[model samples]
Target: MTKILLETLKGNPSDRVPFWFMRQAGRYLPEYREIRQNAPSFMDFCYNPDQATEVTLQPIRRYGMDGAILFADILVVPDGLGQKVWFEAGHGPKLTPVNTEETYAELSLNGFHDKVGNVYETVSRLSKELPEEVTLIGFAGAPWTVATYVIEGAGSKDHAAVRQMGYGNPELFGKILDLLVDATSEYLCAQIDAGANVVQIFDSWSAAIPEPYFHKWIIEPTREIVARVRAKHNETPIIGFPRLSGAMLETYVLETKVDGVSLDTGVPLDWARDSVQRHVCVQGNMDPHLVVSGGDAMVNEATRILDTLKGGSHIFNLGHGFVPQTPPENVALLSETIKNFRR
Candidate 1:
C-alpha cells in the first residue's frame, strides 16, 4: 500500500493532502491520560514498549491520521549520553546542567545504544502494529535545542546562559553541539534500522539562536546529521522542523538537504509556498489556538491553509503540539476538513 505521508515527503502529489498533529498522542486524549497514569514515571512510560506502542497507536485509532510519531521524548538523547534527566509532575523536564568542559567530557556515547534500546523496540512494535498506509515517524531534538536543556538544566524563559556561552565560549559550546550531532545521528539511524519509515529532527529553540550563530549552530549540525543518516539509510525520508527560523528557513532546507520542511505558525503562507514548498514538501503552520476555538473558525483557518498550499506537496498539521485543554471534537472536525479538501 502507498503511504501518503511518505509519498508527500518525496514531493509526490497524493489524491488528497495528508495530515497529522505534532503531539497527536498526549494528555489531550482521555485514553492517553488513563494509560499515562499507569506508568511509574514519564520516562518509564516512554521506555516501556508496551505502553509506548499503545499510546502511539491511540491517535491513529481515533483519527486515522496519516502519520504516527513514536511516543518518546527528546531528552532520551541526554539520558543516553550518560547525563541525569527526569520529569517533575507540574514542572517539565529537569536535567543536571552541563556547563564546563569537564562535565561535557563526562558525557559518553559508549552506552548510548544500550540506554535507548527500548525506544528502538517501541519503533519496531509500532511498525508491526500500525496500518501500513499510516507512516511511522521517529524523531530527536536538534543539537542546539537539546544543548539548551543540557546547559540550562531545564526549560528557560530567555535561554540567556546558552546564548552567552555560544558567543563567549564558542569552543566549549561547539564541543557540546558536536557530541549531540554524533549521538543524534546514531540514534536516528538506529530508529530506521528498527522500523521507522521516516524521521524528523525537531529544533524547537532555533529562533533563540542569534543570526550570527545560525550557520554554525542550526545549519551545520543539521546538515551533518542528515548526511550521516542518509549515508546509512539512503532511501528513508527525513523532515527538518527548524521552528521559527524566519529567513533562515530557506537556508536550512538547502543546506540540510531534508526531504521535507515543517513550517511553524509564524511562517507566512505565500513566502512558504514560493520559497520553501517550491523546493521541498511543506508540512505545517496551523495555529493551535484555532483548534481550541473550534467551529467555523477552525474550519475556516484549515481551509485557508489547504487552499494556500494545495498546488504543491503538503502535509496539513498544527504549527506546534496540542495543549491539554484542546477539545477532542475539534480534532475530529479538523481531520474531517483535511480529508475532504480538494485542490
Candidate 2:
C-alpha cells in the first residue's frame, strides 16, 4: 500500500493531506484507560511490549490515522540509562538529580539496549501489524529536552536549574549533553532496525531556552543525532519538533537538516508557508485546546489550517499532544474534517 504520510514527510503534500496527532492514543480514549488498569505503573506500561503495542495501535484502529506514533515516554531514555526514574501520581515524573559530571557518568550504555529492548520489540510488532498504508513513527526526547529532566530531576516551570547548571559548570553540563547524543543515536538506530518507518525527535522544552544559547543547546546536539541516525539508516526520514522556537525555527530547519519540522501553536500560518515550507515538510501549528472544544469550533480551525497549508507540503496535526480532559468525539470530528479536505 502507498503511504501518504511517508510521502508528506519526504516533502510531498498530496491532495489527500495525510495526518496523525501527537499523543494520539493516550488518556482521552476510554479503551486506553481499560488497558492502563492492567499495568502497575506508567513506566511499567511503557516497558511491556504487549501493552505498549496495544496502546500505540488503539488510535489507528479507532480513527484510521495515517501515522501511528510509538506508545512510550521521553523519560524512558534516562530510566534505561540507570538513572533513578519514576512517575509520581498527580505530580508527574521524578528522578535522581544529575548535577555534577560524577553523577552523570554513572549513566552507562553497558546494558542500556537490554533495559530498553521492550521499546524495540514494540516497534517490531507494530511494523508487522499496522495497516500497510499507515506509517510507523518511532521517537525519543531530544538530548537537550531529556537533559533538562536529568538536571532538574523532573519537569520544571522554567528549567531554571538546568540553565543555572549550564552557566555555573559548563564542563559538567557539556558532558551530560555529549553522553545523551551518543546514547540517543543508538536508541533511534535500534528502533529503525526494529522496523520503524520514520522517527521524530521531540525537543519539547526547546521553547524554554533563551535565544543566545539556543544554538549551543538545541541545534548542536540535534544536528549530531540527525547525522548519526542517517549514517545507519540513510533513507529514513526524521522530523524535528522544536516547540515555540519562534523566528529561530527557520534557522533550526536549515541547520539540523531534518526532513520535516513540527510547528508549535505559536507559529504563524502564512509565515511558515512562505518561509519554512519552501525548504522542508511542515507538520503542524493547531492548538490542542480547540479539539477539546469540539463541534464547529474545532472544525473551523482544522479547516483553516488545511486550506492555508494546502498550497505546500503539509501534514495535519496539533501544535502539541492531547490533554487528558479532551473529549474523544472531538478527535473523531477532527478526523472527519481531514478526510473531507481537498486542495
List TM-score per model, in order: 0.99, 0.98
Candidate 1: segments with Cα more than 4 A from true spot? none
**In candidate 1, how many Å is residue 302 off?**
0.4
* Candidate 1, run of 10 with poorest lDDT: 207-216
lDDT of each: 0.94, 0.92
Report the lDDT tens digits of candidate 1 across residue range 206-317.
9956677898999999999999999999999999999989999999999999999999999999999999898899999899989999999999999999999998999999
Write the residue-wise lDDT of candidate 2 on 1-343 in tens digits. 8899998887666789999999998999999999999899999999999999999999998899999999999888888889999989989999999997679878988899999999999999999999999999999999999999999998998999899888888899998999899889999999999999999999998885777689999999999999999998999999999998898999999999999999999999999999999989999878999999888888899999999989888989999999999998888889989999999
Q: Which runs of model 2 end up more than 4 angstroms from their true locations?
A: none
lDDT of 2 at 16: 92
Per-candidate clashes come to 0, 0
